[model samples]
Target: MSAVTELSIVLQHDIDEQYQYQPGEIIRGTIYVTLAKPTAIREITVKVYSEGNVSWKGPDEQVYQAQEVYVDSSKAIVDTTYDIEPLQLPQGRHDFPMDYILPENVPSSYIGKYGNVTYTMKATVVGANSRDTAISSEPFLVLRRQHIPVLAQQPLSMTASRRMLCSCSFGKLDIRVTLDRGGGVPGEDVFLQAELKNQSGHTVTAMQASLIMTTVFRAQSRSTEFRQVVSKKRDEMDVSRGEGRRWTHVRLPLPPYVPESKLEFCDIIELDYVFQFRVEMTGGSEVRLEAPFWVGAQPQGLEVPNNEQAGRRIHKGWTVRGSQALLFPDGGPGDGENGAGDSGGQQPHVEHDYDEGWGITLVPELRNASEVVTNPLYQHQQNHVTKGARDIPEELLENTKL
Candidate 1:
């Protein structure tokens, strides 16, 4: 009785891993259609869609929301037949080939509590009768293949110290975190060396290492924040006053589901991560330190183990230098993919104090993103956001970049 019984969109090369598409890669699939009888079809169409949106309420109950769309394309693959007759698709199974090239600027898929960024594909068939229309959609992931520097792939560490006065006795506690490398892709393990020192009268009850993700939502000059501990390992050990403990080369495997650092291409939402080393002390007090690193969608080669180097105490004059993710404006730590490091006769030396424990992306003075040779890694920002050579802000520009 019905013209179409089933309609579905299926990928051709999903033979394996999660169906992931890089910007330059091809997305080949097939649209499977099953018709109950001969159907007069007006047209068959395929569409691609990508979007990011954020919604949350401020303290005053004012709802703040914003959305950005990166891709929305449609094509008609089948149309009317000759002699003004609609094309007839015979009963049984029919296959329509699908092919598409993802754009280079597409961001990765991220599902958050208050915000979500996603990419999807849909195919539709229109029959002579409106009731015979059949449609199908499939969601996929997009990760801009990014690269970090060879230098940034090396080991990195950070320290946090706090002085406590318990029972009128001056005491101190110090904690440090070290990782085999500063960055890696999903499914890889991040080797860690954590140290804890307790000169205070309080007892060390527990020590924990956690991978935390922070998601920030910005809209209309307002923003909200959310933090979740994705992975963590806790060690229960007690060492009384005037003692120190250390663990070497403890493996903390990164979860494959987490998003990449900076989450470029989407403007309304920003996500970052931190590796936290925390110690729970007596009297319900806690001392913690965090080291930041980049996690990407593509994997890098594993370097030599740094077990010996990871345990070394962080000494004076060993100030934590900011990762290249801060100095280079266009990409990741190396960020070579975006063509950021090219310079003039002199590579500028800019000395400024910044947070080393956060994956900070520096601004390269974007006057207009629509202009040629723009910062593809950071074009999602507003112009006035950065202080330029002439002290001109982005808000003053005629055609502000997005």
Candidate 2:
């Protein structure tokens, strides 16, 4: 007698393989199962859940992990037994449709090096025998609704002044920074306008602007923060007393991989960003100004390019090789093709040469060597520079001197 040998499951969604959705949207799909022969089963069940996983290694070689289940649900489609003579029948294929509506306040799905937010659906078949259970699962993506507050849509501007007395001589420096808008999304450019007036006796050496990201993680009563410079632009200037320098339209391109601010879905983690403008003065305290902003997901119908296209647009020196092109990590283009170039009509392979040094390099090592260094005086004044959703602190504003 022939018995059930193989079983399989397939998930189908209205959006095909994209599997992306916004909050409060209905996720509708169908599950198909194939059986090789007649089978007896107890019940077929399906489950949907959201999960967050955090894992990292400490400096002392210790491993740490924090995981949580945000949402979970299960349903049974076939809960009756098929052991009866009339109810039992030969099976070749079966199909079941399912649907679920995502909650309104769920956090956006994300994948990172140390943590991730994932949503998944699983289907299980429990046979009459305890050991004959079969199961399968599939993952989908969810994007949080990013809305810019009314006040954040207005222009952002800030100014600061610092005076230094050295060797019985005093000088005053004034700096101002402004942005076209206070909020932006990935794949967009932020226009920075800055003014520097060196009224002090000291000469201005240089000026710099940067976009920074600060991420905070809270795990079991312990909280830690990390800072990363996402993008930066600098200009060298020599300004004596009463000389002023102005930057009209300095552009800072935001990369598409940047996540939105305030990941509210994940309660244990938070994120923030800022734009800093600094004027270096010779033999005197530096003038520093900051403008806080938001980086959020692009609204629907905005039509921002994907990661590959965004990379090419931001980095003029980027050379993306074709799928059939030969690539060597340390070798030049003259190296012969290694016979792996033939992708057989699939998506072409692309590579970026960060050594050219035209745009923002996400690699930490490369950025450290290429990006302008933060002035030592400014670094010593503050252990970390961060701007969050709340108002700027009075202490932070008062400590603008470097």
Candidate 3:
């Protein structure tokens, strides 16, 4: 029979606030335990760690899984090494202070469809039976710092030309689009310039621009991808055969909670961003061009809010500078008032997380690699169909092959 009544782990001294921390920062916390009567304890341990995992099924119903460990460590609070067989405690209440130094290369916290990256602090208490034990765990948020100026060094430009013989068979319609820079932080403005020379017999009806985000999931056998348009704008204008148009200083504001580009740390999943311009001409002729860009930046403390800025710190936000927030609906705000109903009523459903890792300690002895946990918000159960990947360029697109 176990006499222990309660066991809990309370995180204290949040670096920025509410268990939010950054790279190379020290994390300080406490562990609390309450007992019903006098009891003899075998040992007590506390562990803090971060990890990334992916699990999915292939076409033939074969499951594929992969995992990577970021930061994993454990400390022993009470041990009965030299004293004797039975180390007894009078038993009422006791507390143990926790101290851990976070690694400099840790990525942000994230939960996506097929994978997740998580940070946890867990404490365990054991007795003679080892079958019955108490465990408590708490999750924290991490925000990664980004360097935008480097990735946005040069402008990204693209052009697509097409000829039509509908009205009278004139010349090729040239459509070109350019951005002042190819990268930006969230909540910042990106400038755009465009030129349209419509010599084609058919008139130009409308033009559109979109900010696209692509996610790629890779395994040993095959790879899959998910592409989406996070933001878009349309301009309805008319142009005759002899007339042309030029647009300058067109502003495309980047949403503050948009996902960052190029998730460098995550092995199973990779992210990339691009800007697409489409021009629809009369007689069913259209020209489309694409320009790749980046989103990896953390704003200054003055620019961020007080309660929401976990340290301004975004890590599970880190892999790409709050990049994972783009995948989960509840992580950040949408175009609407709250976190949902942004553009149309077609907003995607968001799965919530509660007691992400809720269970008794499976192992009492600690050499310490704490435990393996899957975030409740993951989309591992869904069926995925593999598709052919389009050739994505690493630099500015110069051809109409896409």
Best prediction by lDDT: 1
State the C-alpha lDDT per candidate: 0.68, 0.61, 0.62
Q: By TM-score, who's the top model here?
A: 1
What's the C-alpha lDDT at position 227 in model 2?
74
Give the alpha carbon lDDT tens digit for every residue of 105-140 in model 1. 778889998899998898889888887898889888
Off by over 4 Å in 1: 13-17, 81-83, 299-402
- Where model 3 places Cα greater than 4 Å from the true spot, the runs are 1-20, 34-41, 59-61, 81-95, 127-132, 143-146, 149-151, 167-174, 194-206, 234-261, 280-285, 298-402
Evaluated against the true structure, the overall lDDT of model 1 is 0.68
- Taking the tens digit of each residue's C-alpha lDDT, what string does model 2 give over 20-116? 5555544556666656666666777777789887776777767667877876867666676645522243667677655555665677776665677
* lDDT comparison, 1 vs 2, better candidate: 1
* Distance from true location, Cα of 155 in model 2, Å: 0.4
Lowest lDDT block of 10, candidate 1: 393-402
TM-score of 2: 0.57
Quantify how close model 1 is to the true structure by its C-alpha RMSD in Å.
19.8
Q: lDDT score, residue 62, model 1? A: 95
Worst 10 residues of 2 by lDDT: 392-401
